[model samples]
Target: MTSIDASKLKLPLQMLLMGSATKLVAPKTKTVFIEDLPPEEVAKHAPEPAGLVNLGNTCYLNSVVQCMRSIPQLRSGLRAYVPPPRSANSLAAGTASSSPLLLSSLRDLFESLDRTTNAVPPSNFVMATKIAFPQFAQTGPRGQPMQQDAEEFYSNLLTVAGGEMRGNCLTAGLTGGQSAASAPTPEELDGAENLADALFGMKMEETLTCDEFSSAETAAAASSDAMDIDNNTALVEPPVTSYDLHRKLVCNIQGGSDASAQVNVNHLSEGIALSLSGKITKHSEILNRDAVWTRTQRIARLPPVIVVQFGRFYWKATPDSQDHAGVKCKVMKPVAFNGTFDVYEFCNEKNSKGLEEVERCSSSGGRRPYRQKAQGRR
Candidate 1:
């Protein structure tokens, strides 16, 4: 074989190796075809500009790049980051509308590419002012994205300041060509405002917890009505109305702690059912005769032997004034009411064993030490 030239081979080989190393280190554009990526994988990879910076290609993006280009299939990668518009609701964090500039840029680009115009992104304030509250804009000062009513005046002026109807603007239903009738006057508007304030302030229902009941302020409230009326006749007034009913809790829980849970609570699958209309009032009277909202004994001379009803049993009510004021009525095991609610489940029960015993005592002295022998449950 002929002797190789080392000087000639070394220069050629070194040039090739140095060029390869420089290509690996340099920030060269890495183009990817969307068709090459799986549809699901595109979202995972392309995502937004935040993820794009990791791909290292968000800056210097053209303001009006195509969504999908023809030649090498180039597209504005930033379009993927822009949020979806809402008239239709979506479970996305960027549901807040984008600025007008962003919308116009997107719309023109998409339309130029002959693509669908799905998103008309408006800022959150724009949505609130323009869409949710168009009437306010009709009354308040209007500027850019000018309403047609405001625009006619604007094109005439150099730059109008505070030029929208500040006075009360009105709209009337002219349709159906109604017979002569007068518009609602200023007196009606004042009444409407009062009604609005009342509605906004009202609460549907209220609840208090065990800790609330234990408060020193609440203890005074727990005092019997009779005592309160007698001691402070000038300050305390008679309970105008009262309702009551008695109900024995029949169902027993396997665990004592589970048994004592509030029956009305959301976690409980089974509910204490009662006749939806009159039952709560009837039950409330039997339990806490003094619960003013019940209205059961407000007029009547009170029935003897208030029966504690639950399921099939009418349990006995031994009149006692232990926890209550001296004036007592047959108290249900755990009575609850929210005006319209007929059944009350003692949400306050701490455990089940005590309740089970109470049920047995009330149920015509049914099984006293009711204990089931363990089978596979053991």
Candidate 2:
């Protein structure tokens, strides 16, 4: 055996240990594949876009957020949103100095998603959402988050976002130019002019007129019956006739008997038309007589975007089942629709005539028809 100098061995030992430590902490690199690239990268090469990570059973929330993010105007509005002060934010803001928790969380989430190529966890947003709306925090038997309806989340989020946007707009207006004396109260602010309304709100005029006065003879009969012989006093009024704005529309599912005749997108249009079409509803309030009323609705104004929710799940009668009451079942019907939908027929006289004029002008100008067609979506 030959004895070696300890000084020479010390340098070699230190170098070996240092090399191993560097290897342990160094970044690893692998061969890059186009197919395996993140969606943000793929989007540059293809049309693919990134997806969100499912936080528990938060697919409902993810779907709505993705849909909203797809809207350019909506994304721009949310990006521009500056959280109002705590005084203006009426929503649940955990801290006194913080903005509305849900809105702030949503804005932050969107920013994070736009910045990252990887799937976002949305954990903070989910926690903020659960704090703002306990309903979304529903727990299953195992104490995990339960699955929720997408439409319910969509509607609720829109309502909350709209309110916050409107409140912020009011605050901005006050701070920009309006004096405190001239500023309107929160109650006086218009609710129909928010970001949500600008992006997807629609106005509809609903007319409800009594059939009792529809004909001259029926009108005369009603008038005669309105007089009291003993008191010699007349009611001096007609059947209930009213008009108002409709904020929402409900589509009913309709189909034939055979399974092959299952409801489709056409059926959806028909259902909407049925609701807007004239229908006589029986009433028995006036003069102990069977009065009738005809109700109708027309599009007062159209929004830039339209949302169509299919009536998929329904409560079905299950007579022979153990429950023997009813069961919630999803409709297996295959609905088909083209890229464009013609809603010209559904508009009121003013809107219909306006569309016609626009079409004529466009044709005369050698441009594409100015017809507004709704994009069919599921």
Candidate 3:
């Protein structure tokens, strides 16, 4: 065997060894930072618009948030709100027990949405809301998505927002001459105050009457004496009544084919009418034990904003279920409505004629009718 000298290796073998060594070493890669790109390019590459994480079935919350955001007054008010400072007690609780944190989170969420065109995931807002109101944190059996009523969620949100406003008002009032001196007066604060009132308040009058029967002794005495005494009657005074801004209008869809019949075509107006003149039956707490009928009627005042909630969900008997009770289901029928409607027709008699006169004058003057887009759930 002939041994080859170490320095005398073949050129082809040496070249092959060098190539293998180069293959063993990894090549350097170039780093690209977002800062190095153009502003427009950076925006294009930004993370997809934030969207709500579907933590379980949170569609109910998402829907309510969308609807609430549509209200310009609410949006403006919430935007201007600055949450109160956290307290030591609240800090000890380890979570926000008041509206401050929740409102802050909401403000952050709204800002995020405004900054980005895409819908952001309201994870922080949702968590804050859940902490403030535990009912929203409830889960269905086996950790399933729970279904919630949109109206209920809306009510809860309004309650929180209203509470915050009331608390702020009270604080301002109590801290008299400090910041209250500089605060807007009742006249100057009319805009936000009126908006709040219009969104949540209503005024009404209630008339109550009593029907009583004379006692046996009194009856016998009256009959024996043949005297006309008003002992069996009592004079009742009417009471002032107040109602919430949110109105629930119910539709009886049983045994109907047409849209008008399925849902009372006049539901919106009729509901207002009925609420203005509804009867209440109650047992009197007085010694006479009389039956009382209280009639409610709307006052001359009306709110700037009116929320009408259709009673679409009802409890019905479930077929093929022997042990279970009635199940609640939504009415899936469509109700037709126009772009504009005159609610003046449903106002009290005192206001109805006046509104009619105004309408006639406006129509004769060739002025355009006030057109409002009515929104409803089918």
Maximum-TM-score candidate: 2
Instruction: Please give the CA lDDT of all the candidate structures.
Output: 0.27, 0.62, 0.54
Question: In model 1, how large is the Cα lDDT of residue 345?
Answer: 36
As a whole number from 0 to 100, the lDDT of residue 65 in candidate 2 is 78
RMSD of each: 26.2, 13.0, 15.1
Cand. 1 TM to true fold: 0.16
Regions of candidate 3 where Cα sits further than 4 Å from its true position? 1-55, 94-96, 166-195, 206-267, 270-279, 284-287, 290-294, 297-300, 316-326, 349-371, 374-378
lDDT of 3 by residue, 114-158 (tens): 554455688887788778778888887787757667777667776
lDDT of 1 by residue, 7-99 (tens): 666543534333443435644776778767654455445434111111111111221122112111011222222333565453265454433
Candidate 2 vs 3: which has more TM-score? 2
Return the TM-score for each candidate structure: 0.16, 0.67, 0.61
lDDT for predicted candidate 1 compared with the true structure: 0.27
Give the distance in Å from residue 265's predicted Cα in candidate 1 to where it truly belongs: 6.3
Model 3 whole-model lDDT (C-alpha atoms)? 0.54
Selected candidate, larger lDDT, 1 vs 3: 3
Cα distance off (Å), candidate 1, residue 116:
12
